[model samples]
Target chain A: MREVPVGEITKVVRDLFIDANINLGEDVLVAFHKALEAEESPTGREILDELLENAKIAKEEGMAICQDTGLAVVFIELGQDVHLVGGDLTEAINEGVRQGYQEGYLRKSACHPFTRKNTGDNTPAIVHLEIVPGDKIKVIAAPKGGGSENMSRVTMLTPAVGMEGAKDFVLQRVRESGANPCPPIIVGVGIGGTFEQAALIAKKALLRPIGSTNPDPELAAMEEDLLRRINNLGIGPMGYGGRITALAVHVNMIPCHIASLPVAVNIQCHAQRHKEKII
Target chain B: MAEAKRIKTPLTDDVVGELHIGDRLLITGVIYTGRDAAHKRLIELIDEGEELPFDIKGQIIYYVGPTPAKPGKPIGSAGPTTSGRMDTYSPKLIERGLKGMIGKGMRSQQVKDAMRKYKAIYLGATGGAAALLAKSIKKAEVIAYEDLGPEAIRRLEVEDFPVTVINDIYGGDLYEEGAAKYRRQ
Candidate 1:
């Protein structure tokens, strides 16, 4: 067994969280420039311009791109052959978050659901862990903000609805979300799983780099079609109306029992803040 | 694109009357910041007939929860949050003559009706453009609810803060107008 110290995980998580908040990835930046050129609405184009400038300033000053700073959603892919040593993995991750938020001047967004009491330290990150074949550990920090997250939706359509139903559902969600999810948004569609699994993969789909395509030919075509229809909705950047409401549509599909066709649309704002590292 | 029109705070009925949906504005002067937590408390105070932390008449309230400022700055990255969350609270404030709201996203019909009734306007700031938005805020001080952390009500002094009219007192809706002009599907 290859022994890996948990402390290293803590450090990586801390730095990744801060970096993701402060920086905009190149893929997202490229997508922004493309949208800027294609956007026909004057206001929509202006909003895009401001967003580009915002990213540049955030990078130069090493400050967060948005004040929401977001709830830390960490994904851990642990190789089956690796043994974690030295400390509890979960605590170490939370410790990293606490330190990062304080040191980076990041906002603490997590809170009690009912009373709305602040957690103060931004602890207990929403962690998704998967075990794979190698001995290496991979970590991704995607800080999710409340505005876009609150607009996301999920529904279990009966199997009779099929592909057309799935497509319609995504369109309806995007239409209803309108300007609320911060358009030119990224639409992540998770299809053909159980209720909870659908939501999981839908969010997981967002981690894919923007302006990238799905490897599956069938899914890629669907993504292309959906992207076209969504932009046609006329809910341009910041919902001020234009031809480029959604920058990309990522679909992740897996087989499910014969009776269910669950779908979850995880909407991501323009910031699209995420950073990943393989150790 | 038209040149942005400059406007000052303490927006009165006459000043608000000249504005229309789709007009770009450079707002200079004071705006008080509040979000979900702070709005809830302000409503509670209204219901209880208690004094508000600041005068609401003819003032704009920005829906935001800003980050902590860096060592030399007055505030950190601050931008508009979604307005729908405050829909319920807004009508009550507008009933008391609040002039404008700065946020990102659609307002409820009830809120729209109140704006029409009260001559208030809803302005759209580019959502997620926090760092760029922060450049206009020259000063910020927590005026109330300090324990709410980011949700605290802050009095911000901004210069050339950019926004576009999403709704106006004359019943114009920029969001609807803009979308309808572009929808082909």
Candidate 2:
């Protein structure tokens, strides 16, 4: 059994949060560069250029790529063979968020929902933990800003609505979203599972690298189709009417009840800030 | 369908009226920051027939909640937040002489109507470009609602703040026009 000290976990979480906030991951940067090349509309191309430039400035200046800095969401894959020493795991994660936001100068966006009061420090991270068989502890941090998150939707449709309905729903959401989510955006579609699970899966799908494809051939095809349709909307970059409204469309699916075809569309802006570390 | 035009800030009726959908703007001068909580409070003050926290006449409000500034910086990454949430309070603010807004997404018809009536304009900043956007803000000082933390109203001095005219005073909407132009036939 591998015993990881609680202090080490706290340090890892703090460093990961700070790194994720200030840095735009290389995969997302590469995707933006590719989008700039593929964008046919002059305005779309210009928007892509600005996005790339923004990433560069953020990296060079050690500033957050986006002001929202988003809610601190941590996904932990804990090994059953590992034991945590010292403090509670959840508290350690929250403390990391507090330290990172404070030290990194990242915005503290978490607030009391009804009162709309700031949480002062961005504490109480949204942590999702799962126990796996490995001896290593893996943590993934993704800061989801409000614009794209506001556009996220989950619906349980009758099985009769089928794949076409799902596609249409996603396309409609993206179309209506326009420049809000900061195109060229990423569309994460979660199909099947229960309603909540579908939403979770869609959010999780966004953590994957921008251009990676689903292993399943059918799902991959659907992703392609959705990507085409979304770009067809010509929302362009920043909705200035261009050909490249979306950089990618990713889908993650799981089995659901026969009567249900639950779907969730999770939108992510061009910033696409996420990072991972292992302890 | 008109060519894009670049404009500076501290906007006037003439500048706001000349703007059309899809026009690019590089704004300078003073702009303020406010969001949902601040908007609600500001409108409440207006409704009560009291003076606002700041002068709203002929001013632009950015829908943003910025990160804490690093030492020696005026502000941190301060990109615009989603605008639709501010739709409710915007028309009223426009009625009171608000000239422009910098944020993302579409607004309600009432807000559009108010824009036309009041000669106001709504500009869409590149959402999520906070760090990049922050470089343009030369100064930021909280003017009101300090209790709101990030949502506090801030008086900002800016230079070359980039934006696109999403809704012009003439009732042109870049969102609808842009989407229609790009929609598959």
Among these predictions, the greatest lDDT belongs to 1
lDDT of every predicted structure (CA atoms) = 0.93, 0.86
A27-77, model 2: which lDDT tens digit per residue?
888888887787776766767777788888888988888888889999999
Q: Candidate 1, residue A259: CA error in Å?
A: 0.8
**Can you write out model 1's per-residue Cα lDDT over B101-144, one digit (the tens) per residue?**
99999999999999999999999998888999999999999999
Q: Which pairs clash in model 1?
A: none
Model 2, residue pairs in steric clash: none
What are the runs in model 2 whose C-alpha is more than 4 Å off? Answer: B1-8
Share of the reference A-B contacts seen in candidate 1: 0.81
Provide chain B TM-scores across all predictions.
0.98, 0.95
RMSD of each: 0.9, 1.6
- Tell the DockQ for candidate 1: 0.86
Worst 10 residues of 2 chain A by lDDT: A39-48
